[model samples]
Target: MTYIKERRRILVVEDDIDIADLVTIYLHNQNYITHVAYNLEEATKLLEQRRPDLILCDIMLPDGTGTDWIRALRKSADLPVIFLSSRQETEDIVQGLELGDDYITKPFDPDIMVARVKKRLRPAPSTSENMVATGENVWRDGWLDLHFDRFEVRVNGKEISLPAKELQLLFLMASRPGHVFSTDYLFERIWGLDNWSDVRTVMVHLHHLRRKIENTSSTHRYIITVRGIGYKFQAR
Candidate 1:
């Protein structure tokens, strides 16, 4: 199927001129609109002018580390960020993940990077629009209500906030109630095929999601674990 996608805007923040140009070239070839920033200062300036759909950043910058910049960015925006740096240490990768959506080691393949960027920009697939819709762009099942346009979730009329990845995961499962999603499926769907991270990441996020949405006192659980398989939303 030939899918037509809107040109996604991407901000590439890398001090290395050659790397920045290389990334921008690849992204442009994929039909993405890109703005290159040599440092965090320039990136910040560009952000003030226009917000990009995604950000590609390097950890070491001329003015400050990308980690520090991202820490500050998180205070205001939830823009998906992918770290493109040479830092391959376990600690560095974990730290990047803690702040951003994904991390990529330096000297990365342009093809893989573009693929990851596309995955991040793509919206979660829904089985049927009417199946999930209670209202325009809204999904409701009993006390759980999800507003796709606003990225808001309300349980029992009280609003609850979730991280971007968790929200996407919930939307995917809840959109197709009773459909079992294996760990591999969920990982690839939410984290993307370019992600080499362990599948255990799925388990950790599921645990946190369950805690947020599941009402222990009630017999009804929003998300049900299909042991030895994966997980599914409890059918109404």
Candidate 2:
């Protein structure tokens, strides 16, 4: 058994030696402790040894596809899994989105891939609960501050424009700052599993929220990275 110390450990599961090597190297460069697996056996072995914070998997492997691994993992673990695939079929994409954390098509931009991974791993801090809803009123920065009954997210002493989903997600997160919630959790809360809310959908919504709130703000970045964990709403 490997004695693990760091919290932000990542697993890159790919059968292609070259691709796996490249991913492992890049993740290492980002200062994220990483482990590589070439097939189901190796991947399972690594999982048994130490659970990683997140997993990046290629859908197709020599022995099986990433879907196979995800199905198996879903039976026992909720560890985030991002699919890396050569095929860009919608069905495949949807299936993966439904099954995993995120997906990247073949010949992907390493920077984008890294950014996605980092964003998904971002952490939210402790915050009090007084949620703002849509069409109500909330202020952030020097803006309209248009939000209803959700949580108190003051942008420069005002509220900002918020969509329904964003409001719900923020409300949930703000209710408990520094509480990490996975994309799956977000989906379950916002869209519900029965409704087909998947990881990719959650990512898209988070992307929008981050752009609207965090990226534009000069101070008080509300969401911080948690490495391998999920997001937590920042307080102060």
Candidate 3:
């Protein structure tokens, strides 16, 4: 049997032909399949025909605002939406974020734009059924050992206890090794979207988790902060 990876689809909605084409070219360079829509009308029609994995939308659309479109899009789909707008006002940025996952102001670096998209589309921090069945549940490094099945954590060869939430956070990061998980993603996955605890809760839990797993006196770190991004388990 042959296996082929499906390319992730991205919909770009921008009225500027130059910007739209440039964004499309950059997405294509990364091997992601992209569809361009010049306005909200075309974007809506394209969405009806084919739902893309993610969307890069402009705020100032010919038909309507990206924020309004996102409000409607949220009714049907929970996929990631990134706002690519020239609206530089604080209120505009905040509003865009409230309605979308990310907001990139105009004259944005193409590399950063692609990076944000990649981060948003990363594999969710969940162990798959196959992994569970295969018993790929143990993670061991220099001084840290985790038995996810039993929720047992050993540091420096001694068993230690962790709060339920902390244990869960550790397990998720360890499972993926080096995958970056944004605060929003981690909070949603672990605490759940309905949980009242904000993203800061994730930071607090990770801080405690690091203290527990990492050698307090040493300079080595197991959980690395990606700065402006989130955290990743650095197994070495």
Every model's TM-score? 0.51, 0.49, 0.51
Top-scoring candidate (lDDT): 3
Per-residue CA lDDT of model 1 for 1-236, tens digit only, reads: 23343346788899997898689768766655577778888789878765678999999999999999999999999889999999899999999999988999988999999989988874534335313324344555677776655778998889998998899898767544454678997898789876578689888998999899877888657778889999877744
Give the C-alpha lDDT of model 1.
Answer: 0.79
Q: Which one wins by lDDT: 1 or 3?
A: 3
Once fitted onto the true fold, the runs of candidate 1 whose alpha carbons sit more than 4 angstroms away are: 1-5, 122-236
> Which one wins by lDDT: 1 or 2?
1
List, residue by residue over 1-236, the lDDT tens digit for candidate 2: 22222226677888786786577656655645466777877788877765677889988787888898799889988877889999899999999999998989998888888888887764422233322232332323343232324444555445466788887786656533444566776787688646554567877877788777764445556655466667866654
Q: Order the candidates by lDDT, highest first.
A: 3, 1, 2
Work out how many backbone clashes candidate 1 has: 0
- lDDT: worst 10-residue window of model 1: 126-135
Q: Please give the CA lDDT of all the candidate structures.
A: 0.79, 0.68, 0.80
How well does model 2 score by local distance difference test? 0.68
